[model samples]
Target: MMGEAARERRQFWWFMLFALLVIGAGIGLRAPWPADEPRFVLVARQMWESGQWLFPHRGSELYSDKPPLYFWLLGASYALVRQWNIAFLLPSLLAALGTLTLTYDFARRSWNHRVGLWAAAAVLFSFQFVYQAKRAQIDPTVVFFITVGVYGIGRHVLLGPNWRWYWLGCFAAGLGVISKGVGFIALLALLPYALMRWRGWNGLSEPAPRGAGKWWLGGASFLLAIALWFVPMLVTALVSGDPEHRAYLNDLLYRQTATRYVSAWHHHAPWWYFIKVILTQWLPFVVFLPWLLGPWRQAWRQRDARVWWPLAWLLLVLLFFSASPGKRDMYILPALPALAWAAASFMPALVQRRGLRWALWVFSMLLGVGLLAVGLAALFGNPGYEARLVAERGLEVGSGALWLWRVLALMGALIVIAGIVCRLRHVLLFTALGVAVTWLGYGFGIAPLLDGESSSRDLMHEAREQAGADTVIGLVNWREQQLLQAVGPVTEFGFKQPEDEQWRRGIAWLQAEPTQRVLLSQDVAMPDCVDRGQIHPLGAANRRSWLLVDAQAVAGCR
Candidate 1:
């Protein structure tokens, strides 16, 4: 018979293969989620259609709020197949795959193959990782660069003092910066390792020959990478006197970092925000905290750099992001890999102790039972629940809800079986399987019906039919999302009240243009300088929800 190690190797490869297929298949299913996905896809669509690769434009205006790296990838994807949902999500999916590969490589090289696989699987199946990686958002790419940078730097420190690895790390950091403003923060993970290396501890001792020179060269490499995009952008802006470019440069350097960090415009949360997110959103892994305590105690006893590096980095990230007033769940995505590694310290116990494995399975089964209860509740709980869902999310308690429950039940049953079996192979395999099934159910079975109401595709299409496609559409007292999903070039305008300066400017702009259709929020009032003759009120989805106005009624009121 093959040895246990040999068997685990086989299982790991198969599990990875299964995960790969599942994640890829997930891309083929599901529509976009709003407030993020549609906006991103629309921006890329606009960029692709405009052929203006340098500047990102949404509808009629330049959009420079985010750096253009993800947009470039997204626009490129849109150009390839012209499919928004899957195409826009491609970068994140690929980035996630890369991250998994690197995590596996790092863990395998540092520890055993089993440990490495466990570490990767911990991240791959992580709730946040799966959720974020499947979306067309900035977080996945951000996480990828940050993780890759840490992995690269780690090779130089732990394995050997290789110049190339150091340079690679620097390059990754540069890419991370371009990917998201705060990506450079990922390098902070290397600090504890560097400090440990200086002391020559954790099986690492003696300075790398010419390490100081490598540091300068690495910094130079980073600057060169930054110059690839930044310098040209600045020069182009200067030459063309593009006001948008000026704003982009300013935001890129200042407001996005310093101003935004100190006092934010939105997503304002206290220091405890990330703490709550870490506890609630990043559960199961966080459940392994007791498992982690042992490793930390061991590492502290041994003064081991391997353990200290990830732990210290976690501290730094928590402190850094916690200090910022502006916070969101996705903001801390880059820190998850470290958490996984730190958590995977418990994998050593799983390797040797069958009792511990049984305990873990018991935990899994208990968690599964709770999930099963919730899933069952979702299906048959209360008539009020279904009514509330329809009222709030426009979801019906139907086959989709049932399919989700079925998946959850299967998940629970499998966990209970794993617990009963109480074998290491069974535990790892079933845990990974549970994540796979959940995502599969979401991606294939449940998401279609669920997304129908969540997505704005139908509403946008129906409104266009009412307003006529040929008519120029502008939004006043409406969300930018409405314009994003609309059929044509829908102009966006209006903010607070009619008397507000920004709102007045929007009215003036709408009046100046030959707009034939206008979508307004129900609460907003019509302006006085207007032609009352051209205004027509179309039926609305909800009263006081939105107002569809025919701006073609704009008589020569001017």
Candidate 2:
């Protein structure tokens, strides 16, 4: 008979392997795509090149939108690997893996290895978690830090008066704050601990008077982590006497953190928006929700601190994001680990229930059939929607569109067959298999097919070819992708500059050496002063039309 330790070691490695396959499959297969990836990668690239670790820049402007910790990680990754594509996404990948490891261990220590594996699996296969893990974003790293905080505090509260773990958790939360500004959300776990203690909860550390100094130590550890980045950056910004540096300091400290949270400028939605996100974005795991409610209520009635701590933390996080006027789907991602932990505590028996199994099977069928329908429509028929997508995405109808839809169709067919074969007896297995296929399909197959146009690689390639090797190109209202993918000499007027100012600067740059220089501008940013007849369209990228123009296109107006 194998020992429990050996079994746990084997299971842990297997779960990690599965996570790596799901999240790390397409690391180098595609360049960063937009909405956030390109901007973050561009900032990191500039940081690496300029050796300016304190102040991040987007184009020629100071980037005060996010704290510098994430950018620092990206720069460090680049230094180690020296490849932009892989280096750009390395931190998120490692952070995700770290998160999974911490989740697995925390659950294992809290309940048993079986619960740990289930908890880790629940997080691994979730749509939102996998989606964010694969992308080069700050959220995954933030999620990891927050999860670490939860694990540390939960361990100390449930397992021991182990002040060391408590302090470590506090330190991780501090790191989380530097990583995203919401790291302190990790400390919210303590709120439930306090309540549980007051309520005379079972399964808590033997009541021991932890001195106030110990509590202060945790806060100091958190501050120390923040001070690692904040102090040096703040001191430099204050003493530098540079206006841009001061502006960066003010914006990052004030506008981006507190002000943005209180009054979001964009992506606004109703209060119930996160509830909708939880229902949809957190799928497969939520498929067990119906079966979970009774067990959760029972756990609460029994006063289980292990269950209450994470569940309460999850609720607090949900309320935190939901109360904000501005919301995005990924905002609730950090709460997922807690959800997985609470759910996995009951998942062992819940999986055996016939109703939950049927629900999983039904969900699998719907997902598979949905994918099949969309793939079939794109493949066999020239539907108006398909045509519009191809045009908007600038995909080659002959190759790009064909390959993408075929991969989707193939994946859907496999999932449908898996669901049918697995049936009720193995329906739980079917859900895991189906999610694995979907992510692997997306990472290895679909992402590469769309990489060229989606990353603006092809558009920049065309621009480079048309302008010749010696030509200098100036960008007007250009995206980060265009600047990142440029082959030869390139200059951006400004990323955050107004349209008129960018156009004015671009035109002047073009006129400096008209024969040797060209300007690339979005169609919407094209100035009336430019001669439309002399402008050449460079095709569509990221659903925007771009035009290449020469000084001759500058007609008359200043």
Deviation in Å, model 2, residue 441 alpha carbon: 1.0
Q: Give the per-residue lDDT of model 1 (tens digit) for 1-558.
A: 469868877877786776666666557555567657766776777777878777776666666677778888997777787777668778988898888878877777777676777778778766788788878888899889888778877777776677788778778888878767776776786678768767766744235535577778877766676677778788888888878778777876788778888888899988888888877667555656655677688787887776677778888999999998889898887887887766565675744566555555565667668666766776666646545555545444576556656666666666556556644657655565556666776677566755654665555676677767776666666544566566875666532224344345545555665455454434356566444555554333222334455445444434
TM-score of 2: 0.98
Task: Give the least accurate 10-residue stretch of model 2, judged by summed lDDT.
Answer: 201-210
The per-prediction CA RMSD against the true structure, in angstroms, equals: 4.3, 1.2
Task: Evaluate all candidate structures by whole-model CA lDDT and list the values in order.
Answer: 0.69, 0.89
lDDT tens per residue, model 2, 123-208: 88788998998999899999999999988998888888889999999999999998889999999999988888888998788864
Candidate 1: which stretches are off by over 4 Å? 1-13, 205-209, 351-383, 396-425, 494-544, 551-558
Error of 1 at 286 (Å): 2.4
Model 1: lDDT of residue 480: 43
Tell me the spans in candidate 2 whose CA falls farther than 4 Å from its real position.
none
Q: Poorest 10 consecutive residues of model 1 by lDDT?
A: 538-547
